[model samples]
Target chain A: MGEPLLRVENVVKRFGGFQALGGVSLEVQPGERFGLIGPNGSGKTTLINCISGTLRNDEGRIFFRGQDITALPAHRRTWRGIARTFQIPRPFGTMTVLENLRVTLEYAARERARAGDPAVEAMEILAGVGLDPKAGAISGLLTQIEMRKLELARAMAAKPALLISDEAMAGLSSSEVDELLEILLRLNAAGTTVIMIEHIMRAVMRFSERIAVLDAGEKIAEGPPDKVVSDRAVERAYLGE
Target chain B: MQARWLLALAGVLIVGAFVVTRTVDNRYVYFAAYGILQYVLLATAWNILGGYTGYVNFGTGAFFALGAYTSVFLIQAVQAPLVVLIVAGGLVSGLLGFGIGYLTLRLRGVFFSIATLALAVVLETMMVNWEYVGGAKGISIIRPSAGPLFTNYVQLLFVVMAALAMGAVAVAWFIEHSRIGRGFATIRDNEEAAECMGVPTLRLKLLATTVSGCLMGIAGAPFPYYITFVEPVSAFNLSYAVNSLAMPMVGGTTSWVGPIIGAVLLGTLQQLATVTISSELNLLIVGVVLVAFVVLAPEGILGLLRRGTRRTRA
Candidate 1:
């Protein structure tokens, strides 16, 4: 692959004396379907948080699109076309789905006001996430799967070159997971890089072009899905052998 | 079509009041209307942050007091025009709002509210002890001469206050319909989601609080001249905070029309109570009305109207 879209170098995050992420490093290439998987408490979320500027890492450098973004604030990172969906779906409950997308579109337009293209762009995003018809419904009234779709719609509304899906398949049935996975695949096919962090092994294994296994805040395995899944350390980490 | 009818009816009522007050020469009615206008402005200003953004500021009285004192000092020191003083008051209060919001917007929920309350106490003490602007003794304002419209200064004050009231309403309408307004609603509903969706929550909130404070300050700036006195106690009156909080809550905290309805209804009732009943009982009546609405009509009059309309459609 050419230049990596995102690079995390030796990220170290501590909560007082506890090290949540101990010198973790990773890279996501442009238009790559990368899977970040680990057992619980292996710092998957912390790593993503540091990359997204939600948490400051004491020792790390994060480069996004060939620029240092480590010290940038969350909204600044968002404006630079880095978008993320939370593991727990967080739609603006008091507003309609259309209003939620509109706010995101307006924010992005304000940052990069290309003349006369925002509304059409927003509607296209809504259509891509399969939320166009439900746009007028109140977000609080959406079902669990619908809320997840809205979260994805919101992330896409910023027209990010890279999209981070943090456990978007959590709490969904098998068919629902397939539906969401299909959407992620379609987005990746359309030239948007995707980093999907999921605990659902089958889905991640099927979706990731390359898999990286993090165990106890360290990269224990990195390879094709089949090789990483069968690695002695990856198996031991999951089975706690 | 519906909105135009409402506007026409409002115009008719205002013109009717002007004609009747002119014929009867009732300075009292004009004074009452002026007070109602002030409350309308205050409630609308408070709603900008408290209602729209879900950030309840208990320190509105502090901003109001700051505006009153700023105007008093400027008027006494350099004899600025009333219009200039009003705008200056707003600018001063807005700056204070920006400073306070920068420090405290990180605080969530009731902590932010408590911090704002403490701000009022600190401001009141500072103004009470500072002797530059007459300190605890208070400042007296010499009313600016009216330019030949009416020898009766009260009528002129009423007109000015009415214009300001209209301006406040227009601002509330603009914000309610704008993109900033939708961003505020998102922040109110879920700040994390709002930020995730790329809304710059801090900047939008700061703008809301600053604009809210500026308008409150302008509303209070003219009060020193209207009452012809500026004392720390009255300028920092806890009643201002109470009315600012209660009017919006009692009117429906969700819409622009809520505060207007609350202010006019509650303000007229308070004026009538103060005139006929004991002045001390006026506050008692306010407290009673606030409690009644909080318990019985938590969504306020506007919510009631919305529900009534929906039922009719059904």
Candidate 2:
């Protein structure tokens, strides 16, 4: 196969003396829908933080499209096409929904020299996710699902090749979950690779083309969803052995 | 381009101040206008960092005093022109601001604020012990004779301050509407998110500090000539810090207009109170009004008005 889009090698993270991620390795291919699953505190978010440059790994090299990205700051990583949504949606509260996306669009345009109106581009991103009607509404006034969509749209505004969505569907109803899933799938179809960190098994099962299960800060299993779901190690990791 | 209106507004306001200077003969009016315009400059300058970046800087007094002292040293040494003093003051304070931001800006929230507070205290102490620039005993400059254009020095000073106030406001307004302002808004909203959105958060923050400090210093440069006396005690007064923060909070911190509204409203009220009551009571009145506004309208008068208009529309 061609070179993978992202490669995480022996990534370890620690808080105080506690090892949150001992040594986890994984690879995601270009244009693939990847799911990172774990029990609570299984180092899923830590790995995401490491990959997205929010937290640097103590011992690891993160490669993006054959380029080492371990030392880059978060914004530099973003400029090079790494974008993520916080597990907790953080819409710019004081800004209107359109303005919220425009912030990212304007930055990306400056970095990459895109020639178009950022406001129009911002509206397009909002419309793509069914948030166009509330373009002028203050972001803080958005409902939970709307905020999640906004989080994704803001990431999209960066025109990132790799998009990470951390717990984007938490606290969402089943229909809302499906709606968000559809949005992600549509984005993937449009040629953006996505890594979805989620607790919702149904959405993860339906969406992922490949799955990596992290347990106790280690990669316990990696395979197709069916095989990984049925594996004894994965089973014991979810429920006590 | 959209900010051209602000320039026009500045022109009108400056002309109006000149008219008042030409028509009104009373020295007190010029004095009062001077006070209002000074706060206008201070509040506008302070808001660039405090309001925009979500970084609260308590060292405004230090920056202001540095500007005033920059003028003092220049006069004692080379006898610089007022314009030269203003430019030098801005550059000097801006450098100090940038240096401080580089060293201490890594500390977030209240810790960063404490660092600035400590900086102000340390600078004040250095000024007290320093032998040059009058040390403990203040220095006074006999007033320069009235300029050919203006009838008196006070009138010229009033016009200068009015022009500075308008210029500061215009600069603040431009930044608020520009892409840099959006980046600042992101930093204020959620810094981590801003970073992930490709905003060079640290650079934007440093720019805010530099510009904010520079404008404040420029405002301070003319202050020595205004008072005709330069003293560490008065130049480093706590009121600069208090009034700068209060004016923005009372007006609204989000937009450029908020600080101007705050400076004018609170500024006018204080001037009135100082004349009718005691000048000491002026600070007390400011204290009381600030508290009332904080408790009643935490977002300031502009925020209150926006909400009121939104409600009426709804």
Candidate 3:
């Protein structure tokens, strides 16, 4: 295969004496749907945080599209087309929903040299996420599902090549989970690579082409979804057997 | 309104101040108007960082006093022109602001607030010990002779301040409508989210601090000339911090117009109160109005007006 879209090499993160991620490594291919799953406190979020530049790894080298980005700050990393959604929704509360997307389109995506009106572009992204009707509503007043949709739409506004959805379906109803899954699927079909960090087996299993399972700061299993799920170590990690 | 209209409004206001100076000879009018307009500048400056960027700076006195002292030093040493002093003062204070932001911006919320408050105290102590600027005893400055455009030095100073205040308002308005302003709003709302979304929160924050501090320093440049008594006590007065914050809080923190409204409304009231009641009641007026607004109109007058208009339209 061509160069991986994202290659993380032996990332280690520590919060004082507690090792949050101990030398975890992974690769995400271009336009591929990748899943990261683990039990709670299994370093899933920690690994992504290091990848996204939110938490700098104590020891690691991160390469994006062939350039070493380990020393780049979060905003620089974002400008390079890596975008992420928060586990909890974090909308710019004082702004309208459209304005939230405008922030990304104007800053993150501006590097792409898009030549159209940002407001129109923002509306298109909102429509894609099924949030166009609430464009003028204050984001702080959005319903939970709407807020989640806004989060995804805001991330998508960057026109990112690699999009990381971090627990985007947590606290969502089953139907809502399916709705978000459909959006992620649509995005992937349009040629955007996706890394979905999810606790919902049904959604991740259906969505991810391949899966990597992390447990206690280690990647215990990685392969096609069925093979990784059926692995004995993966079962032990989840079931505590 | 668009930026050009705001510029037009600012031009009209400066001309109006000039007309007021030309027609009315009451020195008291200039005095009262200068006090009000100074707050207009201070509140607007404070709102740039405290309101738009969501960073509270109790160090308003530090920046202001630093600007005043900058002028005081230049005046004693080289007798620089007022314009030069204003520029130098802005540069010095802006750099200090950028430094403080670099050091303390990583500490969010109340911790940041405390750092700024500590900054004011530390600077105040520095000024007190620096004997060249009269140390704790303060120094007095003799005003430059009036320029050809005005009758007395105070009148010219008043007009200069009026122009500066209007310039400050114009800059604030421009920032509010631009993309930079939107970046500021995101930083205000959520810094981490802003960074992840490519807002460059640190750079935008530094910009806010530099511009905010620069305007405040300009506001203080004319202060030593106006008061003619350059003392650490008065230059570093607690009123500078309180009024700057209170005016923005009472007017509204979201837009440029809020600080002007708050400064005008609260400032005029203080002038009237000092005459009718007592000078001691000046801070009390700010205290009462600030509490009332915090409880009844926390968004300030602009937010209240927006909500009212929206309700009527709906």
lDDT of 3 by residue, B1-314 (tens): 46677678778878887887789998988888899999999999999999998999988999999999999999999999999999998998999889877854478888888898898899889999999988999898999889788888888888888999898888888889899999999999998899899888888988999999998999888888999988888898889999999999999999998899999999999999998999989999999999999999999998899999999999
Ranked by TM-score from best down, the candidates are 3, 2, 1
Docking class of 3: high
The superposed Cα distance between candidate 2 and the true structure at residue B71, in angstroms, equals 0.9
* Top-TM-score candidate index: 3
> Model 1 chain B, poorest ten-residue lDDT window?
B13-22
> Model 1, residue A236: displacement in angstroms?
2.5
State, as a TM-score between 0 and 1, how close model 3 is to the true structure: 0.99
Superposed model 3: Cα runs more than 4 Å off:
none
Q: Which stretches of model 2 miss by more than 4 angstroms?
A: A113-115, B103-105
For candidate 2, lDDT tens digit of each residue in B77-117? 88888889999999999988887667433788888888888
Question: Best-fitting candidate, measured by lDDT?
Answer: 3
Where does the lowest 10-residue lDDT sum fall in candidate 1 chain A?
A108-117
TM-score of chain B of each: 0.93, 0.97, 0.98
Model 2: docking quality category: medium
Each prediction's RMSD over C-alphas, in Å, is 2.6, 1.4, 1.0
Best by DockQ: 3
Question: Which pairs of residues collide in candidate 3?
Answer: none
